[model samples]
Each structure stands twice: as structure tokens, then as C-alpha cells.
Target: MSFTGSLVLSGIGGLVYKYGGQQSERETEVPVGFQSLTIGFFQARIRVFRTRLETLSRTFWRQLVETSGYKYPIRGVSEMFRSGAYFFPWARAFAFYLVLYLTIAFIYFCTILPVYLALLAFLGPIGFAIAYLHFLLHSNMLTMMVMRFTQLHNSLFDLALVHNGKEIFVKTAIQSPTLPKRYYVPLNTYYFWLNYLPWRIFIFGFGFTVLIVLLLISFIPIIGPFIFNALISPFIARIYFSRFLRLKKLDNKQRNDEFYFNFGTYVSFGFVAGQLEILPFVSGLIYSSNSVGGGLFAIKALDSEHAAAPSGATAAATAAVSGSQARQDTTVA
Candidate 1:
């Protein structure tokens, strides 16, 4: 039997086992008559499932918009360029990326060129394999840049939050112990490139794992690569999403807030983001920005949720700033 055929049969059996087993205790009649099941019970199950589906949809979009790396980056980049301020950070981020790319491409090319020559010398014509390998390696090197620009933009958003139309936020950010001080050079260039290391590992690892799994099931031909990628999309989205959020927290010098995403919200939203990521480059841009959008969205939600109750991160930041001020006062006194 084909893999897909087996999956269909198993899915049916599993569904029956799950729902039937759930109500089995209530219906003690062995080989319980299909006639014994009432419409009301079926309706209740349908309602429960519907509610879950609704929740999943909402949560997925929420996370994608609030914290995703997909859409927010593109939009954020656009906004940054349009504003005409902070031109240096945007330029600096891309420039650093360019430098890193050229450097890596050169090094990898030099190292791998010998390997390529050996393959040609020993094996003779091997189709496009060598060329493809070079391309693949170059792409990998560039992906080392991963979320640099987006993270830089998001970090700026944090400052934007504190400043909120005031000029002193820049001064405060520079002087404040809690808030990250630098804006352009290190902030846009080194910090994000360094920060994205784990994210790069995750994307590469996940992609490689999926490839392995696909190979194992290659004979079955049931689960195509696209279907498989879609299935694992949420997990991938969550990996990047969580990384970006944590980086944001670190940038703000705020403690981690584990409860920010609540129960299934984070994972479900990741799923949605992953699904939307089907369209090649454009989807990626949208999804990245949406991730940041989702994050900003969630922050806004938190602001409302805790309108009466203050934010823990904000409170701690305030305390740190206050302490710094106190120390300065003591020095003067």
C-alpha cells in the first residue's frame, strides 16, 4: 500500500479509536449499537472541535502578526527608509551583511574550489552537482545574516516605545543602564548577526531533518516535500518566533516573560505563519514583518490587559533607571 493510503486508513482508525474510546465508558453495551448514539452527543463533539479550530486560527494569526519574522521586516524596512531618519542603521545593517557575505563567499569558495576541482578531476563530468554545491554553500553563508535587520528594527521599536514622540528617550537610552545604549554600529551589525546564530542552526537543522524524513518515506511517495514542509511549518515558525522575542527582551534588558504567549497561542500562530510562508520570497518578507507585527500586537494587547496592572518588564526597567539616577545623585552629593 502507498504511504498516503496507509496514512488515510490509520487516520480513520485513530479518529474512531479516539472519539469512540472517549464515550465507550458511558455506553456499556458491548459492540454498542450505532443506533445507541444520540444526535446531541455528536453535536457536542462537533461544537468542541469547532471551538478548538476557531481558537487555533486566532492564535496563529495573532502570533504571526505580533512576533513573526516574515512580514514585519519588510514593512519595517520600508518604514525605516521612508522616514529618512536612521538611514545609517539601515545602511549599516545591509552594509555589514554585504561585507560578511563577500568575506564568507571568498573563504568558502577558496576552500571548496579545491574539492570541486578534485570532483571534476577524479569523477569527470558530474552534471550540475558542483555548481549547485557552490550555490548552496553561498546561500548558507548569507543565511548567517538571518534576522539581523529585522531584529535591529525590532530593537529600535523598543526604543521607539520608550521615547514615544519625545527626544529625551534617545538621551535616556544612552544613559540608562537597563536599555541597550548603541543604536547603529554594534546594534545593527554585530549583535544581531551574533544573536541569529541559534536561529540559523534551527532553520538549517529543521530543513535537514525534514529532508531526512522525506527520504525515509521517499518510496511511499505519499507525503510530498511541500506537504511535509507545511506540516512542520509551525514548529519552524515557533523556533524563529521565540528567538526573536527573546532577543527583543534581551535588548530591552528585561527579564523573560514566559507567560506572554499564554497556552497554545504561540505554537498555533506559528502554524499560521508557516502556512502563509508558502509563497517564496514575498511570503518570507511578509511573514517576518508579521512576526514583528504580531509581537507589537501582543505588546499592545498586554498594554490593555494590564492597563490597571503595570508591566513587569516595564517596572523592572524603571527600577533600574531609578537606581542609576540614585547613584548619580549620590555621586553629586
Candidate 2:
């Protein structure tokens, strides 16, 4: 895996530096053919994955271990049961949905268990592969449900962020109710669907194609799933924190730039979040937890950036203080 990752990074870097550098020049100089275009597309994708893999630094791994984000899953589960007027109603709704979801899943699994076992029997030694594929199928099939769950709990996520911020003392994260609100629509609203359906269709169509490719990749041995996870990390990250990103008022272009600029950090964060989300029975709960976790990450990230980057006012204030100190020292001398 290391060798493959390194080789991919090295090769893609060179290819991008060569063919990717001057797109207009290349388009003019060499007639763009289907073959070249296809290669270029794949090259771009490779570069993206390579950049993500390269971003998994040792410090990131350490932070992953230390960060409270990983605990938010259990925290989310606990929050669901916590006693509060605000939480009780939502908790009951979640409980009802969970019961219904699990009941249906139980029946479905009972119906499919014999067939699954037969396949396992036939596959024998490769039963693990079958099981893995089944898990992936189940995980990917829940994408729509995941999105719906996210929509349902958007307000909860916002509140969780506020709570998390208070715990960590990040003032910006503790935003006010009077914050200039963006126009909002409920997920189930007709207007929302009307505006979103076209985009949803495109996303689903593209996602189905990607799913087929991932299924093929899963046929590979151990490293296949790792590679698959790595490739999808960025998308997973964005989806998990889509609401938080919007809350931060990052327009599409700004979000894209942020993702590219901090590609490594996002990938590392997403990879961990994705792993937790791959579990079968608890994935829905993890979805809720992921909102909180993603929020915590965003808070810490913004705080770190804020600390590292002095604001215009902060810089001016610091400069003024320094100049005053210099004058006082000169007078004393």
C-alpha cells in the first residue's frame, strides 16, 4: 500500500506538472483526443486521491486519537436519551424511526439470511469477501437515508456545536440566535424539493456510477477497501459537515478552495468519520454523532486558523503596541 501510494503520488505529480500545467497551450498545440481527455480525467482523480493520502500525517493521527470528535458517537447516543424538553421530543421521534428501521431490517435480513448463507457456503473461503461486499452494499444503499437523517437533525447539530464550543471556549462557535439567517426550507418541503430535484438527480446518477467502480475495487484483497475509503474521504467529509460549512457562510467556491487548501486535514478527519459510519446497525446513530463530531472539528479548525492568522485589527493593534514599547524603551535608555 505504501509503495503504491508513493508511486501514485510521484507519477501523478509529474503528469500533472507536465500535461496539467498549461491546459490552454496543450489544447492549442495538440489536438485534444478522447484518449488524452480520458487520461487527463483519471490523472486529476489520481492527484486528488494522492493528495488525500499524503495528508494523513502522524500529527493528524495523534490528533484523531486525542480529539473529542471520535467520542461524539457515544455522546450522540447519550444525548438522544438525555432528559430535556428540547431533546425529549426529538429523541422520541428518533426512537420511533429507529424501531421502524430496525424492524424492517430484521425482516429483510431474516428473508435474505438463507440466501446469504448459501452464497457463503458456495464461496467457502471467499465468504469473507462476500460478507465485506454485503456490508459495502448495505452502507452505500443507506446514502439517501443518511442524507435524510442529516436533514432531520440539522438543528440538533447546530445546538450541539454551541454546546461543544462552550466546552472548548471557542467564542465564534457559540453563535447567537440573531445571526443573520440564510433563507431556509425544510427538507420535506415542496419548494425545497422543487429547487433540489434536478441537482439530486445528477448527484444520484453520478453516485451510482461511482458505486459500480467501488464495487469492482472491493473485489481486490485487503488494500481495496482502504483505497476505496481514501478515495471517498473528501466526499464523506463534505457531506457530513455540509450544514456546518453552510453555517460558516462558505459559498460553493470558498468551500471548494478550503477543501483543496486543507485537503490533507479534511481527508484525515473524514477517514476517521467514515470508518465509524461504516458500521451496519449503528450507522444511523453515527450519522447523528457525526454531525456533532464534524461540528467540533470545524470549531477547532476555525479556532486554529484564527489563532494562526492575525486579523487586520489584531495585526494593527500588535504593531501599535510594539511601536509604543519601542518608544518607551528608547526614552528609558
Candidate 3:
């Protein structure tokens, strides 16, 4: 009935659906008596599941290190601070939101001060604790909204990818008229508001509601919040890949499938990114840096995938990039 419980149940169901459904066909092929078949089926399932678990664990650690998600956020923040252009956007975003938050907080404080005093008089220190928690929750809600809507950090993410040699790849993809249309999904304001915005709102609402429940369960301790973040981290991690996914031109279903296929990597990346995000007061700055880290991770991961891709596919990608370069040169000539 709890948020954690629901997550656990869903995770179990997902694993079963992902792996268990194959048993019927495999079981039919075994060609054995009922008793032996049952035993062999259980044995095969256990072995297969164990192998998958081990693979996922290894993938998690490898991705975590490769992505450098733990330190990228810090690096991103430092770079933003050092660069006037990057720093300006972050400052502007922070200042704008801070002023807005203060204006609303002032109004709320004025209206709630009398109620707080009455509660304190009747409930002693408990009322003060309740009020403090209320304020913390309110601030968190504002912080999340700002983080989601402010597009400032995404540029930082792109900058990171460009620095790591994705510029040519992305540029080619953009220029190549022959590239798959999916790879060139136009991301204008209309798309953002009409398509991306609504989905994000739904996800944010559901995720934050679960988080609030978890936080309230152990408001004074770190345990509940930690668990909540870890459980919800894969979703958070995917946000870091939004730009990269757009480049690949995956739809919602394809994107979700991609994440599910690389569940370990996503979870590990999200866990580290989520930890960085949990820092109070400076989350906007941290989030910006995390974007840089995500870019670095994505580049590394994609490079690895490129190496592993079939020779024909690699050749096609190369042709796309080369063709784009040729077209550019022709235009200049």
C-alpha cells in the first residue's frame, strides 16, 4: 500500500513479464515427463535469472564509472561559474526563481502566521515541527518546478557533448538529408508544449507525490528519502539523456524500451545523479553540472556502442557524416 511497496511489486512484475513469459515456448521444447519438466523449468529459470542479475550488476558498475555521473555535476557547476555565458543563464534562472519564490513565500507567510501561532499555542513544539516540515515541502515543490521548466541546463549538456567529439556526429545528422527522419525529430516550442510538456508534468506529478509520501514517513531522518530516490532514479536518469534520445529520434515507446534494455546502466547513472540533486539550496547549479556529466556519459556509452555495432551499420553512419561534410563543402564552393 506504501509507495515503496508498490514499486517493489511493479519491479517484480516487470522482471517476470520480461523473462518468465519465454518459459512456455522453451518448456514445450524440453521434451520430458511432467515431473522432470517442472524441475528442469525451475532450474533453468533460476539459472537464467541469476545470470541476468549478475550481468545487470556488472553493467551497473561499469556504466557508473564510465558515465562519471557522481562527479560530472560538480564539474558542470564549476565550468558554468567560470564561463560568463553559461554563468549568466544560471544566475538569471536562479535570480528569477528566487524572487518569485520569495514573493509567494511572503504572501503565504503573512496568511499562515496567525494559524501557526494558534497551533503552537495549542500543540507546543509539535506545531512548530509541523510548520517547519510544511515550509520544507513547499520549498521542495518550488525547486522541482523550476528545475523542470528552466531550459538553461540543457545547453550545458550540449556543450559537454560537443566538447567530447559528438559535434561532428550531431552536426552530420542535422545536415544529412538522407539520414532517417527519426533522427531529426524537430524540437521546437510547439513540440515541447504540446508533446513533451504534458508527459513530463504527469511523470513529475506522480514521482513527486510518491516522494512526498516517503519524505513524510520519516521526515526527520534520511532513510526514507534515500530509498525513494534510489527507487525512482532510473526515471531521473533518463531526463539526463533527453537530448541524446532526441538525436536518435526515438519515440516514447522506443525510449522506454531503450532504458529497459539498459536498465542497470540507467539505474546506476540515475542513482548518482539523484544523490547530487538531493543537495539543498544549490540544486539548480548541481542539476546543470549533472547535465554535463550526463553528456560525457552518453558520449562514452555511444562510442562504445559504435565500436560494437555491425560493420554495415557503422559504415552507414560514416557515410551519413561524410555525405553531410561533402554537401557543406559543395555549398561553400
**Model 2: ten consecutive residues of lowest lDDT:** 21-30
Full candidate order by TM-score, most accurate first: 3, 2, 1
Where does candidate 2 stray beyond 4 Å? 1-93, 96-100, 103-118, 123-150, 165-208, 215-231, 313-333
By lDDT rank, best first, the candidates go 3, 2, 1
Most accurate candidate by TM-score: 3
lDDT of 1: 0.40
Better by lDDT, candidate 2 or 1: 2
lDDT of 1 by residue, 206-306 (tens): 96687558534422222232354345554444443443333332321121123232324454454455444433233434433444444443455445556
- Per-model RMSD to reference: 19.4, 15.4, 13.7
- The candidate maximizing lDDT is 3
User: What's the TM-score of every candidate structure?
Assistant: 0.38, 0.50, 0.55
User: What 10-residue stretch in candidate 1 is worst by lDDT?
Assistant: 21-30
Tens-digit per-residue lDDT, 53-127, candidate 3: 676676766765665555654566665666664665566656654664565445545664445556666677877
Which segments of candidate 1 are over 4 A away from where they belong? 1-70, 113-174, 178-256, 259-333
| C-alpha lDDT of all candidate models, in order | 0.40, 0.50, 0.55
Prediction 1 TM-score vs. true: 0.38
Scored against the true structure, residue 12 in model 1 reaches a CA lDDT of 55
Clash pairs, candidate 2, are: none
